[model samples]
Each structure stands twice: as C-alpha cells, then as structure tokens.
Target: MTCRVVQWATGNIGTHALRAVVRHPDLALAGVYVYAEDKAGQDAGALCGLSPTGVTTTRDVDEIVALGADCVLYMPRLCDLDVVCRLLSSGANVVTTCGEFHHPASMAAEVRDRVVAACAEGGTSVHSTGSSPGFISEALPLVLSSTQRRLDTLTVDEFADLSYRDSPELLFDLMGFGRSSTDLAGRVAHAQAGFGPSLRLVADALGVPLDALRSHGEFATARDTTEIAAGTLRSGTVAAQRITVEGVRADRVLLRFRATWYCTTDLTPAWDVRDTGWQVTVEGDAPLDIAIRFPVPLDTIASVTPGYTANRAVNAVPVVCAAPPGIRTTVDLPQIVAALG
Candidate 1:
C-alpha cells in the first residue's frame, strides 16, 4: 500500500525531502505544508524545482491535516511542538528532521508522556532523524562496532563549513556565531537538544547504561573581523564553537559526539578543519577510524547533500508508521533502505 505523505516545509532539508517524497515509489505526496506566506500559493513541484505536481502548497494546518496523510515529512524551520502534538493526535504518523525529539526517548518525562498520550489517543507514531546527530552518531557507529568484540571508546565528529548554509539567522543568532565567546550557552543548548538522543542510541546499542551524561561546549575567538556567507565574525567575538555530548560509564567516556562549526579565515590556536565532512573513531578491538565526504556540487542553494537527511527521515516513515504509538527511536526501527531508484 502506498503511504500518503505531506511535505511540512520547504527549508534546506525540507526541500530535499519534498523531492524525495514525490519520487519514492511507496509514498505519495498528498499535501505540502508551507509556513511562509510567499510559498503558500505556489505549486509543490515548483517549490522543489520539479514539474507541476498538482499539489498546491498552503499555510493552512487544517488543510494538510484534513488530507489524512498517512505520514508527515515534518521539517519546519524549527520544531513546533503544538503542530507536532496536534498531528499525532490527528492520527498521522510523523517523521521529522526538525531537531524536535529525534529520539523521543531523550525527551523529558512530562513531554514524553504527552507524546505518548497523543499517540495512544490517535494510534499514530512520531520519529526524528538527521545526518549529524543521527546516522553518524547512532547508526553508523553501531554498525561498525559489530565486528569489534571489545569496544572502549567511540567518537563521532562533524566539522562543517556552514558558509554553504543560507540561514543567516540560524548561522548567527541561534548559533551565537558572532556572539561573545564568554557566553556560549545558546549554542551549547542548541547542540544538546539534538545530540542527547543520538548519544542515548549509542549507549543502548552497546548494552551499556551510562551513569552520567554531560554536555561540553567551547569556542574560539576571532583575532580580526572576517566575512563569510552566513554572516560576519567580529574581532573578539566567537569565530568557532564546539559542542559535545559525552556518555560516561564509571568516570570513563564510553561514547561521545562532537560538532565543531566555524566561519572565519583566522582561527585562534589554529587547527585545520578536516576537509572530510564527518569522522568516526572506534578505540576498541582493532582501533578503527573512518571519514566521510559528500561531493556537494555547487548550486544556487549550496547544501551538503541535504538529500542525505531527507532520505534518513523519509526511509524511516514506514517503520515509524507501523510501530506502536509513542516516542520511537532508531532502536525501534530496522535498517532503513531507500525507496528511490
């Protein structure tokens, strides 16, 4: 049976998800949810740079919900809890990359309970996935560890050049890009929200329960003002920031994920940004290190295979929709295979 899908937004990742939804053989694009007034009246196909699909975009939440889509590719600018809750209660399974409880297991008890209640009330499901806090940290590491009989430490790092990202507000304000290094709480909070679940996924996979989990954040300051695509980096302001989630077992770091993002020509105590987009190291049995690089071809809207994230969430829709209601994680689903040929 073909699963009906609604594209929730047309943002960086959403744009890719929209295209994938239209192409997936097992999925049908029933509706397109637009948040921006300018995008509301356009055709869904036009928004994704495709031929007319007869799926006109609309900002009306009621309209999309009324479409009775079986699954929602719920990517908005950010997580909108009210919207998510309402959708779950409306009997629609949700799969999002919006950094909203990607791992429902990591959410607070109260919030988790509410999601559970919504799922029970509607008999639906919700899942969250992404590229960084997602497969790299959770899925890939566990897959690599299958060969290792003994495992000690696992580290996943992502050094991204956000210059390719177009969201100025996201790159600057939300990320504290030009903010004072003295105050990095905002940036740290942003990373923790996403990384927490991925860390949990790793610990669960290894059958190791962490005694304590901690968030670590640090930043480097710019010696001189510099300009980048996202925004400007002023002297003395933050030029680079690192966010880490460490899962501890008996005082040793068993698993950890770190994301370092910067946008300057001069980095203090300089370190070269690894040209590889991602790196995963396993200091166990045979000691392994792996790096990944995606050839993000130059385009008007620069992105690093945003399709990777789109496919991550889209491929999980079937499993999430089939699962019992509540917060589902990577642990709840099997290996996701792409339906796009």
Candidate 2:
C-alpha cells in the first residue's frame, strides 16, 4: 500500500522530506502544508524546485487530512502545539521537525499532555526525527546497547561546520552569538544548541531517568580570523562551541555526549568530519573504541540521493505512521536506520 504524505514545512528540512516522498516507492505526496502566511498559494513542487507532483500547497490541516492523506510530516518553524495537536487528533499520523517534540523537555506540561491525549483519542501516532534528535541522538545509543552487558556508559560526539550547513540560523540566531569572537572570555551564547538534548536523548533511549544526569557545557570562539567562500566576515568571530552532557545514576556517569559545531576554517580536516564519523567508547573490563563513518557523495542536494537529513526522518515514517496513536519517541517505533544503496 502506498502511504500518502503531507509535508508541513517547505524549508530545507521540509523540502528535503517532500522530495524523499516523491522518490520513495512506498510513499506518495498527497498535499503540502505550509504556515498560514508563508508561501500559502504556491505549488509544492515549485517551492521545492521539483516537477509538479499534482500536490498543491495549503494552510488548512483539517481539510488536507480529510483529503485522504494517511500521514502528515510536520516541520513547523517554531514549536506550534496547536497545529500538532490538530494533526494528531484528526486521526492522521504525524512526524515533526520541531525541536520540542524531539526533546520533551522543550515542551510545557499542557502542550505535552495535549499531544499525548490527542494521539490516544484519535488513534494516531506522533513522532519527531532529524539528524541529531532522530538518529545520532536516539538511534545510535540504542544500537550500542545491543551489545548487552552491565551498562557502563555511552558517548556520542558530533563535529559539524555551521557555514557548510544550509541553515545559518541554527548557528546564529538560535545560538545567540556573532560570527566572530573578540572577547577572550568566550562569553558569546550558543545559537544552535545541540548537546544538551542529545545527552538527554541518549538517557531517554537507555530508559534512565535524568534525575541523576548532570549536564555541562562550554563555548569557544575562533581565536584567529576565518571566512568561508560562501559568506562575508573576517576574524574575531565566534568560531565554534562544544557541549557535553553526562547522564549519571548513583554518581556514576552512564552516558556522555559531546556535540561541537564550528566554522569551516576552524574545523580541522573539515571534509572528513562532514561526511560522518563517530567514536563510540564502551567501558568494561576490556574496554572498546569503535568508529562509525557513513560515506556518501559530498555534494549537497543531490538529485539522485535526495537528502541524508531528510531520509533520516522519512525512513522512519512507516513505523511511526503505522503504530498505535500517541506521542511517541524513537524507542516507541521500530528501529529506523539510514541505509545506503
């Protein structure tokens, strides 16, 4: 059976997800969902630079869901609880890109309960997935735990270049720091804060309460001047930031996660890390160190490859959409890993 999908946002993430649906044999583009004001009347294909797939974009979730779309992939710009609730309660399965859904701590009590209840009431399933929040944050740890031993600890580190990323807002506005750094104190706040929730995700996946988890973070800026071929800006800019999250039970750290995003120049061997490489250390009598690097072509937005980030979310849709409705986490769904052909 083909799954009809409604894309909620048309931004980089949404567009990529849409493209994935268009290419997938198991999924079909039913309709596109945009914010009330942003590109409401445009064809979904035009906005994403794809050929018309007979899917028109609209701002109406109720009407769209009623159109026989089996699932809605939400990519709201902000954590809009109302729209998410509507999708869940309408008996349409949902997958979102909002950071809040990826990390429940980002949601308030009322909104969280509302989403959970909506899913239950509508017999619909709701889930969120992305690069960090989805696979690396949740799936990787879950994969490691398969070894089956007296669990000691797990650590996941991410090294990325902000300039290389399609969205600069994640590093600038959200992190709350300029591109350059002048103050020696390293005082600028982070914009694309990733580590905190990443650690928490690992904890949640491991079924450990955060009561004993300890979080610590440190930010750093480029000491020397740096500039990317794509953008303007000289020295004294915020270069990079590092954050670590350690989950502990009974004063012993059980999980440790470190995430670092940097400018291209500040990134040593930037090309290598950008592709995908991780160090997994297991502590036991013998101890073990494992490195996993997923390789694909380096070009961004490849026509044939779709988008890796989008695939991470889209590949999970089957399990999420088919599951019993409710606000579910990665643990709630079948293991969805990004595979290469």
C-alpha RMSD between model 1 and the true structure? 2.8
lDDT of 2 by residue, 57-82 (tens): 88876668687667888876676777
- Worst ten in a row by lDDT for model 1: 295-304
lDDT of 2 at 138: 73
State model 1's lDDT.
0.80
For model 2, give the 10-residue run with minimal summed lDDT: 183-192
> Each model's TM-score?
0.88, 0.79
Tens-place lDDT per residue, model 1, 1-341, is: 78999999888889988988888898899999887899988889998888999999999999988998899989877778888989999999999886666566567788888888988988998877877667787779878888788889988888766655567888777777787754667656766777776777778777887777888788887879877767677888877778888888889998888887777647776755664378889998889988887656423325546777888888888888888888777777778777665
Report the lDDT of model 1 for residue 290: 89
Error of 1 at 42 (Å): 2.7
